[model samples]
Every structure is written in structure tokens, then in C-alpha cells.
Target chain A: MSMGRRLPVYLLLDTSGSMSGEPIEAVRQGIKALLSDLMSEPTARETVYLSVITFSSSAQQIVPLTELMSFQEPSLDANGSTAFGDALKVLEQCMDREVVKATSTTQKGDWKPLVFIMTDGQPTDSWESVADHIKQKKLGNVIACAAGPGADENMLKKVTELVVKLNSLQPEALKAFFKWVSDSIKTTSQSVAQVAADTPIGLPKPDPNNMIIVL
Target chain B: MNTEKATLKDGRTIEFVHDQPRSGTMKEVYFTPDRKSVVCFYKDPCAGSDANRLQRLQMILGAYNPTLPQSHGGAAQNDIEADYYRKLFCWPTGIVVQPRFGLVTPAYPSNFFFPTGPVWLKGEEKNGMWFIGPKNRKWFEKNQPSELGSLIQHFSLCLQIARAVARLHNAGLAHSDLSHNNVLIDPSKGMSIIIDIDSLVVEGLFPPDVLGTKGYIAPEVLSTIQLDLKDPKRKNPNARTDQHALAAFFYWYLLGRHPLDGRRIPPGNTAEEQDLLAFGSQAIFCEHPSDSSNRPEEKQYVPCSALGPLLYDLFIRAFVKSLHSPSDRPTALEWVRGFVKTWDLLIPCSNSSCLHKWFVFHNSTDIRCPFCGTRFKGTIPFLKLRAESRPGQWAMDGQLAVYNQLPIFKWHIYSRVFPSPETDRTRQAYCVFHEGKWFLVNEKLTSLTSPGGNRVPPGQAVELKDGAQIRFSQEHNGRIAEVQMIRS
Candidate 1:
């Protein structure tokens, strides 16, 4: 496959009854910062677009593929059950749309879209159907991360390319994780803008001085 | 967009307020945003909103400029440190911004506890803002050991202290006021980062007058003339100034006290042989000096000797040069190589192969180990890509790109780059490229099979409908020759 030049990222967040207080608020604020970071890079802003997906009893797309300056913050409320399965289906569908957009157009060498999934509780619905497609990387690169209290690491494994445990179920962990996500997106966008498809550019490693990365 | 809550395949929820600008700095800064750039200045500790502003300032300033030390802008290309403050402030909000420029203070206020000292960090989105100074005495009083033996025994923590100072020097600025209090510690990480940069001396306009704490200061500043920090023309703020502080800090980092002829630092200073002796030994309050030999002692100070000689060498250099003049001192660039070589000694890691085992030079393409060919981690590409695009198709002919994302390796398909079909029952999947349509044949996967419900078991064989039109276009030199999408 010809390498893609741009990266479209979607951050899927879980804001349910359990994630009400600080945890949910932290996610909202974190996404704002992440988008802002993406916007600041002149090259990245021009090439990459960001989206947000929040799931509770049902999954919702809070933001579409909007550029940073035009992108608005997503207000989140914590209520109802965690319908993780539904959220996955929505994410896969959204990714399909974005990928299809890339392919249909003459756009060449754009990166496979990235989906970041963050959560903090057990699923109230079965995710078997959606999970199977993701494990096969059906849409693109799906990275599902778990944060805060009650996140089912074992279950999250099904949805993620990698799983991480927060040292605490507090705001800092999610904040740090999002920061990492923001930085990673920034780095990737910058690399694609400057290098060939076959060069070597690695992402920032876990700063031992800061957050820990869970395998 | 009306903010909404969401969940993943694996259940979890988060609450939040999206897109609002949280520009109020994190409780310790004051800045004035302008059209050209964001200019911020740091002052002494503030009480309320001012404090938050400074806190935000602390989170935002960074050191990734390759041209700081007059090194070609080549270095900055490799080390792209994020404007962390932007991330910190943006966290919870996800409004990341870039900082284009910066400046730091180089001296401590006369009255350390007085209302406020000042610093300024210049950036693109914002300008210089005020910052607060440190409370070294209060911090030391609460943390350090009273007994000489205990302080000396736990001296290893000082390596972090030295590295903290080195970081400032690496940024191409001199820490004019190198007092213990000017350094702040993140209690959680157990390492310190320099603060109170109100008097930081930029290397570009340097070598300024000698700055920093009296106890930590090299004898040249004391023996020569006290720097007029306001007078921006002194040469004392050279790398030598930071180097002196580094050597002295190393001694303190190990022995837990300043090497002196009493509580009062010997007036004789670097010119004195005794001060040189103390430095040579890497001892401050204790009689025992760093022994070059001995496994337990050597290993404990970080068994790896890759950097021991450098740190040990600096102590001697400071002892001799910090005497009557600043001219004889080593430069920050020189010391960057020194500490960088000996980085492991300062912060010893439990894992011998850990990246933290030593400070790794960055901004390179292939990272062959300095000793062995084992690749180092986090190296970014340096070659600039030719900016060429033919409408929607960017022609990236001569430039290099990095596939940082690991290739997708599945049961039937080993990898996208190099695929050899085979299948384990659990991971069986058939990829059909008939009529030019790519699809994955799925079966139901078990809860034990997926990560956070990210995957499902293959069930009944079914043709998938992914809801998309594929248009693969072959091109030569930015010209799209053909396009195809035949979904059967």
C-alpha cells in the first residue's frame, strides 16, 4: 500500500455514570489541550483533523473531522450504563467513513487513521461483534486505553492495540495519557510532512521521570 | 459542538467540558500576549491568580532549540521536546499551543524570602511572563539529614541535582543563581528541576558576570567582582559559571553539605588547595571522598563508569578554575558532553539496558549503541523532506519517512509489508482482494481473546460490508496515472 501523507485521529472517550466527577472533567479538558497542540503545529494543523466520540448508555460523536482552530470543546455528562460495544461500532463506522474518504479521493500516502479509546469501567453490553472487526484492524489503527477506577484491563485488551494501567484512577493519569497521545499525534504528523515513507522516526518513549507505560 | 459522553467496546465513562480555553496560568505566573509572540515574565511567589499564572508558565517553557549554543539549528531538529506547560494547561481541555521563544532569570533575590524574584520565558504564542524564586532553606530544613554520615551516605540523590543544573546549561543559558533553593523537587519523581530562573543568563548574549548562590558559586565571582545582573554585558555567566555550580552541586549531591572551612565558605575560594581537595574527593561535609576503585562504592554510585571520569574531572576543573577569574572556567557546551557522557553516574537505573541508564543523545536517524550496535530508543529523523505535492498527491521522492506504527501482524497475514498466509484457529481470517475490494472474514472471538473487547471471535463465514469506496491511484512523480475500486 502506498504510504499516506496525513493522519486523521479520533479520540473516543467514555463518560458514563461512574466517570461523573473529576475523571470525566479531566478527559474533557485533556482533549481540548490535545487539539490545541495539534493546531499549533502549522504543518499538522493543515494536514490533520481531529474528532471526539463519547459513550455512555449509547455512543455519541461529539465532534466531527474539524481542523483545530475550528474545533470546539466537547461538553460531557456522566449518566447511565457503559455501553462499550455500541461505542466500538460507532468508532469503527466513523473510521470507515474517514478511510473511505481518503481512498475515494486521489489523496495518496495518507496514514491509516488513528482511534484512541479511553475508559474507566466495565461494559454493560457485549462487545463481541465490534471487537472481532477491530482485532482484525478492520478500520485502521485502533488503540484502546483504560484509565481511572474500575477499568477492565482484560476486556479493554480486546479493543486496544495496547493496554495501559493508570497508577491511579485520578485525573493525573488520564491527563498524562492524553498528553502522550497528543504528543504522539504531533510527532507523527511532523514526520510524515518531513520524511520519506521508509525512514526511521520513533515516538517518545515513556518518561520514567513522569508517567509509566503499561504493557 | 454540544459535549457528549461516550464509551468503548470495553465499558468505561468520562465527564468533561470540551474546548474552553484555560489560559489562566497554573497559579504562579503573569504574562502579556501580543501579536508577534507571547511574552511572559516570572516573578517571586504570588498569592492567588498570579500564582496560577506562574504555575502555568512553569508547565510551558521548554528547551529544544538547536541553535541555543551556536550549534547549528541541526540539533533542535532531533530533540522535539513538547512545550509541556502547554500540554499541562491544555490537559483536561486538550488545547495544545507551541512556544516559539524563551528567556530565564540568572540571579537570586537578595532577600530570598522577600515578596518576589522575577523570570521571563519568551515564546511564539505568548511572551515573557513573571516567575517565582525558590525557598531553599525551608526545603532543606525539612528534608536534609542533620548528621554528616547520613547526609554523605545518601549523597546519591545529588546526581539528580547536578543533572537539573546541566539541563539549564544544555538549554544554552547559565543558571546565574545556583542555590539549593533555586532548585525545585517533584517529591513524587524524587528528582529536581531548576526553578527561580529570573536571572538565567542566555548563552547567546553571554558570558555574563558570574551569578548564582554564594555557597554554590565559583570563587571567580567572589574573588573577582559580584555580577551586576542588570548589566547584560558581563562574561561571568558562561558555561564555566554553570560548571562551577555543577561540580559544587555534585559534592553536595553526594556529601549533603557545602565543602567549606566552616559554615562560612573559606574566603580563599578556588585559589585555596583545600577547596580543590574537597572537590577532587566529591565530598562536602564528610571526610571520605569518592573512591575511583572498589566495586560496591563504584557500582552504588552507578556501577557503569561511562560517566564517572567526566563528573570526577569536573570537580577538579571547578576546584582549580573557579579561583580568581571566570576566564579559566569550562563552557556549558563542554560540560554538556561531560555530564552527558557521565549521565548514568548521576541517575543510576535498576535496568542496565534502560534508556534512563544514561542520557542518550537524540535527533538521529539510526541509533546504533555507542558501544554495541543495539539501537537506542526515541531517535527522530533529521533529513528535511522536499515539500512537493501534485494537488492531492504529495510527491515525496527524495525524502525519508518513518513507519513508527508497528505493522499489523494477524493470524492469516503475518504483516502488511511482508505477508505470508497462515492461521491459528483463534486468529483465522481470510483476506479477499477480489474485484479490488479488501475485506477480513471474521469469526466470534472470546472475552479471553480480546483486549478490552477490542476484538471478536470469528463466527459464521460472512462477506463484510465496511461501508466505503476504495480508489487506489498509481502515480509517477506527482502524476496520478490510474485509479481503481472494483468492489465485488
Candidate 2:
């Protein structure tokens, strides 16, 4: 039997000081729920490879790209300043190293990765240059979510055009965000991610009360 | 733990779970009190506001519905016929008009779900993807081998899907979104059921709401996917496209790989662009006779030819000839007929430990199991069935590779009856090897005549020897069977 190409998904979370206590616990729960949900789906489990990169004082790739069956929930903690710029740099490195590209010799390659960035506070580091490079290069379908009021939508907008916002860092809102992420990944696996290379992803509509899409 | 009431357009009331319901792409699903049925409400507020959707649902539950008898304004002729179709489809039963645009559908049969397994797998619906896709199949092949059924069982799964699609096409309807997500299969018992009936495409009236799933989408439809919905060049889902999906499903079920998902990479800088070209405009069959560039990279694979000549011809017609030409594609009825004929050619493998316990007996001279490469070492009997085409001329109709207790049915004895929903399925006779000699005992045939022209009555048998012939029936369109014994 021919094994299929992988659909790599990278989750970048902000473990800044503001995202402590209840907010951090909710993020842990969300990761747990997302893993179980993706594992149960046959197509998602077959092609979806997941990784996690967290940034507090500095960014670190907590989990390497792994299939759903073998993926473990990484231990998360909240402290220090938000190094959003460092996180983006780490994500770029991991994607370049892990994502496979189709060439003349190799017929099969990984799908363009789906990247989700969740942050509740502003970056305390210089991030403008890396953000412009990532956006101009069109690395992947990067969806940046401005979590809570402390997060600036415009600053995150500089990173990717596809942006959504959560009104609060409450556990319920974070859970809903993760649920939506799972649904989006499921839809991509089950359908053509985008009709063309540059079109917006055909994602399922989210709950209006908890989440808002910044068009 | 709250409950709510929903009123249907027909003045019936149903209660459902009131809390945050489980939602799908387009609908929010709620379970009824006893869990016998589910009430699904369309998420878009405009869906129920429009009258067209109401009319479409009415048509689906009424004249076009196969799960209901004609007396109830459905397509089926009688109760028994309707009963048979009920097992094949989870047809919507009612329309919910009060709460929102919704449908009431029966819960899937229990067998469509995994009864017990790992916590992640238990109680989950047996979507066709779980059993057919390469990665998931690998998991089953390693951890739970019982879920992966034998080769014959997979064939029967394809046959049932063909039969179900034939019924829909017979009524001039098409399941626009026919994919693994909408079709559930239980390979253990050789059963399949099609869900999501509300998305059916009705000609000149209701258009399809969805384009279709990724891998199952027809080439023409995907090629024109970027076109505007109202554009004339945009090809929508129809019966022909459904034929493409039906064939793809059959290929996946039998071969354990996709037919068109090959190694040929198209020109595109991004994955999405490459996919659009590879699966749409530049689609190529992996097993194309002349084009070997798109061949699967797997070191070992069971070629489509392993399924035998009858099915191989259909596969070629489906993937190679009509991949881009929708009109030239093999119809669902054609697939049904092909599988019915192929069913007679099936024989159990001699290898006791073979993963595929049954295989098509393609060649008697080179009797071998394609899966395990085991050759048979004994005498085998074959009954070549013929039908009278002229006054005294008998034409070759089909051949049955005989095995112990292989029962013959009405379709075998009578030439007019092709196995369908309304066909009589009673067994007419059976074959058995007694004392090292093959005998086809007469069980229900009233006019079973031996090669010597003597009537072999019920409870009597005729020895199937070399050059022996038997007339299955003396009535109009009766078939004659010529026995050939081959020793390997």
C-alpha cells in the first residue's frame, strides 16, 4: 500500500506572563482535546502531522512533527515576556527543516503546512522584519488569532492576512478556538484546502459570540 | 439536561437535546429522546428562510425517495421492495419547519459502528475511509486485523454500493456528494449504507449544494471548480459524476489505493495549485497501459488485472477512457451487472493462512492465488453457462467456478432474471463433491434434465463428469450448463 503525503500542522502558543493560571490551564486542555479529536478522524490521523512551538521569554519547539497516534500533549507553563518574534523565527526553522517539497526526483511531498498562532499579549521583542519576510514569502496558510484585549490585531495582521480575534482569554473562549482549529483541519483534510494556491481556506463558520473574523 | 420541542411541517412534534448540539459543516445535529433518530438543523439562517429548500426537501422525502413504498408516493413499488432499500440508505423521514430548516433522519444501524475497540475507536461510525485509506488500513493491518476483511468481502462491499447507486440512478437522481464520508461500510458482513441524502442533485429543479469531497470529486467538476457558479462552463454534480465517484470507491475498496493518485506531479509552485492540476485538468490513471510515468511507487501492489477480465475492462473504461469524458463513463447499472457476473467466478483460496481468503478464478491452467502465490494441486470443476439465443443455438452467457456447496440461484437457471431488488433470490440447486466426484444436486428445479435427457427430480442429483451437460430448466429462456473438469 502506498503511504500518502503528510499534512503538517504547527501550533504556536504564547506562554507570556499574562497567560497564567486559568488561561494556561485552558490551553493545556485545548491541546489535549485537539489531539483526541484528530486521532478519531481516519483521514486526519492518516495525513495530519502535528508540532507545537511555545514562546515566553524566548521561543522553543516543544514537540517535533509527529503523527496523531504517537503525538503526546506537551507540558505547558506561563511566565516572562512574549517573544512573539522569536516564536516566528523558530516556526520558520522547524517548517523549513521538516516540511517536504516535491521535486523532480521525489514525487511525494508534504502539503503546505497550516499554522495557527495564539497570543494574548504584545511581543516584547523586535518582530517587524521577520513578520514582513514571512508574509512576503507566503510560507503557509498562517492564521493569527489576537487573543483578549491586550493583543493588538493590527500588529498580528502584519504577519498574515487571515486573522481572527477572541474577546477574552476565558477558558470557554480558548476551548472554542481549539475546537474551531480542529474543525478547520478536518475540513482541509476532507476537501481541497483552497481551490487555488492563494485563495482563502474554506473553513467552517465559527461561533459569532465567542470569535470574530477580522476581514 | 434540558429538552426542547420541534414542530415539523406535517404537524408532528419531536423532542431533542437542548444543550449545545454537535455541529457538522452545514448542520447542527441533535439526538431525539430514545436516540432512534436525529434532528439536523441547517446552520445558515437563510437556508430555512428560502422556499426552494423546503420544496427540495419535499421532493427528496416524497416522489424521489426509494426507502418508502409507492403507495406513500415514493419510488419503491411495494413494501418488500421499500424494505430492501431502507437497509441501503438513511433517507430523511420528515422536515422540521418551526425551529429552522431541518431534517429528521433515522439513526444509523448499530452494525455501522465499531462495537468495541480502543477508546478512540469504539462506538465510532465505520466510515469507508477507515477501512480503505493506506495509513488507516496499515494501522488495522498491524493492530486489529479482524477489521480488515477478506478480498471477497471487499468485493461484496463494492457490489452493495453499486446496487445502491443503481437504484438512485434508475430514478434519475444523483447523490451529488457521494464520498467515503457519506458512505459507511461494514466489511465484516459485506454491508454498506449511504447517508446524507438531502444533498442529492435533482435535474432541472434542485442544484447540488456541495461540490464534493477532495479525492472523490470528478475531474470535470474539479477542473471547473474555480469557475463562477452561474457560468455555463462550470460542470456540476450529476449522475455521470456520481459514476466517477462510484468507480473510485470500488477501486479503493479492492486495491487499497486510489486509482488516479499517482506519481505524476503537475507544474505548480504550491501544493494547492499542483493538486488542482493533478486531480483535475491533468488527471492520469496510475495503471494506464501506455503511460507508466504516473504508476504507483509502491514496491508491491495487486494490479487491477488481478480482479479478472470482467472488472478490469470496466476499470479501464472508468479510469482511462472516461476519466475526463463523463458521458463515456461506465454507469452504475453497468457496474452492478459486471459485479454480478464476477461473483460467479469467485473461488476460495487454497492457502489457509492467506490474508485474502478468496480470489477470482481467472485461469484454470495457471491456478494461483494472486495474494500469496499459492498454486492449487487438485482437480477443479467449472460449469460454463450458456443461453439459447436461436432455435437450436446456445451462446456463452457466463462461467461458474464450482466449489463445495456452491448454490445456484434463479438468475443462474433463468436467463431473463438479472439479480435486482425485485428479483427472486431462492436457490434452485447446489453443487457438492461426493466420493471424489462433483454432483449438482437438484433442490428446487422442477424440470432439471440430465445430459442423457432424463428428468432429475428434486432430491435427485446429476454427476458432473467431463463433457456432461445439464439443462437447468425446460421453461422459456432456460440455461444449459456444460461441465469441464480441470486437473492442476
Q: Which candidate is the best by TM-score?
A: 2
| Deviation in Å, model 1, residue B116 alpha carbon | 26
Model 1 lDDT per residue over B95-130, tens place: 112121122222221211222221111121210000
lDDT of 1 at A47: 51
Please give, for residues A1-215, the per-residue lDDT of candidate 1 as tens digits.
01123467888888889888887888777887777665544335445778888899999888886655577887889889988899888887777666434223233324556677878888898897788878774454566676755787778777654665665556677777877787667655533212222223234453243355456
Model 2 complex DockQ against the native: 0.55
Give DockQ for candidates 1 onward, in order: 0.01, 0.55
Docking band of candidate 1: incorrect
Per-residue lDDT of candidate 2, residues A1-215 (tens digit): 12457788999999989999999999999999998888889889888999999999999999999988899899999999999999999999999999887553565667778999999998999999999999998887899999999999999999999899999999999999999999999987776546456667778787688899998
lDDT of 2 by residue, B1-488 (tens): 68889999899999998877877788899999888999999988988877777888899999999899999899898998899989999999999987777999998899999887888899888998898777788888788777877877887878888988989988989999888899999988888899999888887888888888877889899888888989999999999999999998898778878888887778877667777777888988999999987887687888988888989999999999999999999998899888889889888898988878888887658888888889977777888999999979999898898988999999999888898878888888999988998999999999999999999999999999888999999999999999889887
Give the number of the best model, judged by lDDT.
2
Q: Listing candidates in order, what is each one's chain A TM-score?
A: 0.85, 0.96
Write out fnat for all predictions, comma-separated. Answer: 0.00, 0.51
Name the regions of candidate 1 deviating beyond 4 angstroms: A1-5, A100-102, A192-202, A207-211, B1-122, B125-488
Model 2 ranges off by over 4 Å: A1-3, A193-195
